[model samples]
Target chain A: GESVGLHLPTLSVQEGDNSIINCAYSNSASDYFIWYKQESGKGPQFIIDIRSNMDKRQGQRVTVLLNKTVKHLSLQIAATQPGDSAVYFCAEIRGNTGKLIFGQGTTLQVKP
Target chain B: GAGVSQTPSNKVTEKGKYVELRCDPISGHTALYWYRQSLGQGPEFLIYFQGTGAADDSGLPNDRFFAVRPEGSVSTLKIQRTERGDSAVYLCASSPARNNEQFFGPGTRLTVL
Candidate 1:
C-alpha cells in the first residue's frame, strides 16, 4: 500500500532558531509534493510545494527539500516563532491525480 | 477573496443516524476536494470534483459515504447510518485547477455517539 510517514512525531525548537521536519513516502510514482501547517482548531494551511523535477523550493520563511533518490522530504523553517508552532504535514500527489496522500503530521513546537 | 467555507462548524449525531456536511468553495474555483482527519492524524482524501462531476472518488471509505457537487461551487457530503468510527473532522478545499495549490476551509467536526 502507498503511504507517507514522518521521521518524528514532534519537533521542539527555540525561538529565532531554525527547525527541520522530515518525511518519507513509499510511492515512487508521486510527482508533486506539498507541505502544510495546521494550528489547533484550523484547517491545514498551504506552506510550500515542490515538484519531483525540483529538489528544493523556498518560500518567504520556509523551504522544502525533496530527495527523489531516497524518497525523502523535509520542511525547514527559519527564525522559528511562536506562531510557527503547529503540526506540519507533507503530502504527495501520484502522477496527475489531484488527490493528495498526507503523512501523519509532525508537531512543531517553538519555545520562547 | 473568500477561502473555502463549510457550514455547521460542528455536528453531533448518534449511531445509525444520517448526516450531511456542506462545503462552499472559493468563487471561480473549478476544483473542489473533501478530506477526513482523525484525532492526532493528518487529513485523508475522500473525493475530488472538477466542475460539476467527481473526478475521483476512490478514496471514499464505503457505500455509506457519498458526495455531490451539483453546481460545481457547493458540495455536500452525505453519510448514511453513521457509526462511531465515522467521528472525525471533515475538511474541504478548493483550487483554481487540478494539481494546483489548494486552499482549505476550517473543517467540520463530526461527533458520532
Candidate 2:
C-alpha cells in the first residue's frame, strides 16, 4: 500500500519567521511530490512541486526539498506571514499512475 | 478563467439515502479527480478521469460509490445507501494531465445523518 505521512500535525510560528514542515512517503516509485495549502472553507491550492530527479524547487515564497534516499519531503516558507496560516499537505503521484496519495496535513499558525 | 467548481456547497441527508455531487472542471483540463476529506484529515483519492473515460476508479471505497464524467467536461459523484461514515467534504480537482498541478474547487460538504 502507498502511504504519505507528515512528521507533525501542527506547527506554530511567529509572523516574519521561517517555518519548515516535513513529510515522509513510503512509495519509492513515486516520481512527483506536490505541496498544497488549504484554508478553512476552501479547497487545497497548489503550492509547489518537486520531481524525483530534483532535490529542490522554489516558488514565490515557498521551497520544496526532496530526499529520495530517505523518502522524505519538506516545505519551507520564508518570512511566514499571518496569511500563510493554513493546513499544508504533501501529496505524491503514484509512479506512472494519475492517482495522488495525500498525507495527513500539518496545520501552520502564524501568530502576529 | 474560472477555476474548478462544485455544486451544492453543503448537503445533509439521512443515512441510506442516495446523493449526487457535481463538479465542473476547468475548461480544457484533460484530467479530473475526486477526493474525500474527513475532518482534520487529508483528502483521500476516490476517482480519476481523463477526458470522458474513467482512467481509474480504484480509489472508490465500495460498490456503493460511483462517479461519471460523461462528456469529460463535467462530472458527478453518486453514492447510494449512504452511511454515517460517508459524511465528509467531497472535493473536486482538475489538472491538465497526470502529474500536473491540480486546481481544486471549494468542495461540497456532505453530511449523512
Candidate 3:
C-alpha cells in the first residue's frame, strides 16, 4: 500500500532532552512532506515541511530530515518540553489535486 | 485573525441516522479539504474543494458521504444513514490557493452508536 507510517507509536523524553519521531513512506513519487503536532482536542498544526528536492529543514526548535533513499522521514525536537507532549503526525502531498495524506500518529510524552 | 472553525465540537448519533458537519475556513483561503481521523490512526482524505466546486472526491469511502462549499468559504459534510464505522473525528483544512501550509480547524468528533 502507498501509505505513510511512523516507526514508533509512543516516545518518552525528559524535559531538556531532544526528541525524534520517525516516519516511513512507500510512495516514491511523493514530492513534499510535512510534520504536524496535534494537541488533545485540537487539529494537527504544521510544524515544518521539506521538499523532496531538499533533504533537511529546520524550524524554531525542530528539524525535519527526509531520506528519500530509505523512504524515511524524521522530526527532531530540541529540548523537549512538557508543552510538547502531543501526538505528532507526518504528511505527504503529491499529484495534481494537491491532497495531503497523513501518517499514523506517534504520541510524544515529555516529562518535566 | 481568526483561524478555521468547525461547528458542534462533538456529535453523538445512532446508526441509520443522518448528520452534518460544518467548516469555516480562514478568510481568503481558496482551497478546502475534509479528512476523517479514527482512533489510533491518521487523518484520511475525504474530499477537496477549490472555490465552490469539489476538485477531488476520490477519498470518500462511500456514496453515503457528501460535501459542498456553496459560497466558497463555508462548507458542509453530510453523512446519510451513518454507520458505527463512521465514528471518527472529521477535520477541515484550508490553504491559500496553492500554498502547501494548510490551516486546520479543531475537528468535530463524531460518535455513532
How far off is residue A54 in model 3, in Å?
0.8
Candidate 3 C-alpha lDDT tens digits along B24-108: 9999999999999999888999999999999999999999999999999999999999999999999999999754689999999
Candidate order, lDDT descending: 3, 1, 2
Candidate 2 chain A lDDT trough over 10 residues, lowest sum = A92-101
Superposition TM-score, candidate 1 onto the true structure: 0.98
When only chain A is evaluated, what TM-score does every model earn? Answer: 0.96, 0.96, 0.97
Quality of candidate 2 docking, DockQ: 0.78
Candidate 2 lDDT score relative to the true structure: 0.93
Docking class of 2: medium
Q: TM-score of the B chain in model 3?
A: 0.98
Second chain TM-score for model 2: 0.98
Candidate 2: tens digits of C-alpha lDDT, residues A1-112: 7699999999999999999999999888888889999999999998998889999999898999999999999999999999999999999877444677899899999999
Per-chain TM-score of chain A in candidate 2 equals 0.96
Off by over 4 Å in 2: none
Question: Of the pair 2 and 3, which is ahead by lDDT?
Answer: 3
Q: DockQ (C-alpha) of model 1?
A: 0.84
Which lDDT value does model 1 have at B36? 99
